[model samples]
Target: MTSCEVGNDPFLITADQVGKLSKETRVSQLGEIYKQDSIVNRRFDSTYIFGGNEIEIYETSGNQLLRLDPKTPGDTASRIGDIRILDPAFKTEKGLSTRSTYKEILENYTIKKIENTITDAVIFLEEIPAYITIDKKHLPTIFQLSTTHKIESSLIPDNAPIDQFWIGWE
Candidate 1:
């Protein structure tokens, strides 16, 4: 329940526990614990037309694990939902992540600066009000875990960069 949290702090994922892994332990448990700059891809949605349905990425070092998305809906179709950690030695149990810089996350939270420029800084996690992001060298790249309900960061656009960081279930 807790351990599945890939990068840190209560980053839980349900949908029947990623639909019970199995595809060789979801490609060998994060590629045997981030085997230094690992990478694998099976992406699709080339603007979704039916033939565009697949989605199974698993990067390493910079940490990304969007396991599945067969049909998207409530996200049980493939499980392992969204998670993006820009490495920083991977953390989250309050240890933070994305190698934590930018003055150590502005001395630990309270950030906002939207309207383009790589969509930098917009963290908001006062206990599961999730909406994390970082780009202007702050590192921690996106953690939009299911919006945490009531999310409305201006519908998250600001010129969409930082690898298009936006996971949804709304």
Candidate 2:
């Protein structure tokens, strides 16, 4: 990832810069790489119209990395007005990606488990507006890194992977 577009160090990609990334991926000659996708760049738009271009998709994960518009999630997006990252290749300073298990998150950040019955659960952080949603094992599924006070309850696609959901500024 050091030779990648974002930069040489994954730690430089802080929680604040999460949305700027292209949530989609592809298996390049070098390996799996995640670059900026136009649809993801246009996700902040309130309009639900994306003209005629086919939404860019990540090859390996098969997740729609971008959307025509978030307001109308009939296509790829689950909701509008928020950053959603489903790519496991994206990592944190400690190399904790969406693919990391719940137990791994505990090692990086000291957090108590939240009693959740649903498949999608959240780990609310006291310091940052971010809340980490994880599976039963405590692995991070999605990160609600919202500083703008967006509603937590948003639409999630039926068939989309439950591993990565980013809820923050679009």
Candidate 3:
């Protein structure tokens, strides 16, 4: 007997045993929200809104985010720098979804300058809130996007090449 019984074949593996092998791994952490004013730059600080909510980033060398608050004295008010976005919900017609998640907006993006100010950047998904532009150092410097009519769950990742969604009139 090779430690195998006739009734207990490979197919006899129970669900409870499978459950025992399952383990949980830590993915991300919750983010804290803040609202304040900036006294240094006298403008709405950009650090608050830079990193998305509750999302942890593995690498943030070329990411960018806009500040979202004011500050008091001796405070570096507005700054656009590398950020981490957690729990990013794609914009859907019914509003943002709490289910689907993405690591980064432009994970493997490529940019081509169509014109001087008008550039064509290819992103993984379409209907993104902003298109991030990277510099020679691969640091995101410019972020541009247009507003458009929200399609029902339209922001879902489509395998399509180019996105035809537009916010303003043609």
Candidate closest to the true structure, highest lDDT? 2
TM-score of each: 0.22, 0.42, 0.18
Output the better candidate (1/2) by TM-score: 2
Model with the higher lDDT, candidate 2 or 3: 2
Which digits, one per residue and each the tens of the lDDT, describe model 1 over residues 60-147?
4445554333334223334333444333443434444544433443455444433323334455443222345544333223423322
Q: After superposing candidate 2, which stretches have Cα over 4 Å from the reference?
A: 1-12, 19-81, 112-117, 126-129, 136-162, 165-170
Task: Give the lDDT ranking, best first.
Answer: 2, 1, 3
Model 3 per-residue lDDT tens digits across residues 48-130 = 64423222222134322222221122233322222212222222332322232222322332222111123333222334232
**Better by TM-score, candidate 3 or 1:** 1
Report how far off residue 58 is in candidate 1 (Å): 5.5
- Model 3 segments beyond 4 Å from truth? 1-32, 35-75, 79-84, 90-121, 124-129, 132-157, 160-170
Q: List the residue pairs that clash in candidate 2.
A: 101-139, 102-138, 102-139, 142-165
- What does candidate 3 score in Cα RMSD to the true structure? 18.4
Please give the RMSD of candidate 2 to the true structure: 11.2
